[model samples]
Target: MMRTPAPRLRTYLSGYVLSLVLTVAAYLLVTHPSYSTSLIVGLISALAVVQFLVQLVFFLHISAERKPRWKLMVFIFMVGIVLIIVVGSIWIMNNLNYRMTPQQINTYLNNQGGGF
Candidate 1:
């Protein structure tokens, strides 16, 4: 019978350190606010993707799979689902924001006898 080898402590530790570094980096970026909002957000997003890869490789050991083809397909499907959900949520929120002008808000509030 073929047995899979157990993950070494070094792998876990590396994943932990990388996760910690990414978290701290993101925190520092937000707290310092040295860059433009869009740039900072883009950097954070990139960091998040890197952090996800670190977790998958070091912790999940996805790269160690004997049959990686199916795993890759599943991962792609999961990513697609996540993207759809995120994009749909953003689209809904943007549409809501577009519909709710400041003037319309004030008029609605006045009609409702002010301040909810």
Candidate 2:
């Protein structure tokens, strides 16, 4: 039987440091907003994903071990959930952006000779 090595202090420290850096980056992106909205959104999303992986691998020990298939399935399910959430959010925001405001709605109502 092969003995698996346990996680060391350095691994945890690295993950912690990376998470801090990513958090700081997200804060800076929100505070500065120097880049385009789309660009900023993409960067923040990417950073969040990287941090998630880092925490999973380093802290949660999501690596090759017993029940590898189970781990893979869980990871797949999590990815699917994240995809659904991100896609749904983007879709909703896109639709809201294209929707007419109250002013436009009033103008339309006046033109159509309808008010309620």
lDDT of each: 0.90, 0.85
Q: Taking the tens digit of each residue's C-alpha lDDT, what string does model 2 give over 1-116?
A: 53335778998999899999999999999899999999999999999989998898778777734554677688889889998999999999888768978778789898999855
lDDT (Cα) of model 2 = 0.85
The TM-score obtained by model 1 is 0.73
Worst 10 residues of 2 by lDDT: 63-72
lDDT by residue (tens digit), candidate 1, 16-115: 9999999999999999999999999999999999999999999987777665357768988999999999999999999999999888888999999995
TM-scores of all models? 0.73, 0.65
Displacement of residue 34 (Cα, Å) in model 2 is 1.8
Off by over 4 Å in 2: 1-5, 64-67, 85-116
Model 1, residue 108: distance off in Å is 12
* Residue 56 Cα positional deviation in candidate 1, in Å, after optimal superposition: 0.8
Question: Stretches of candidate 1 above 4 Å error?
Answer: 1-4, 99-116
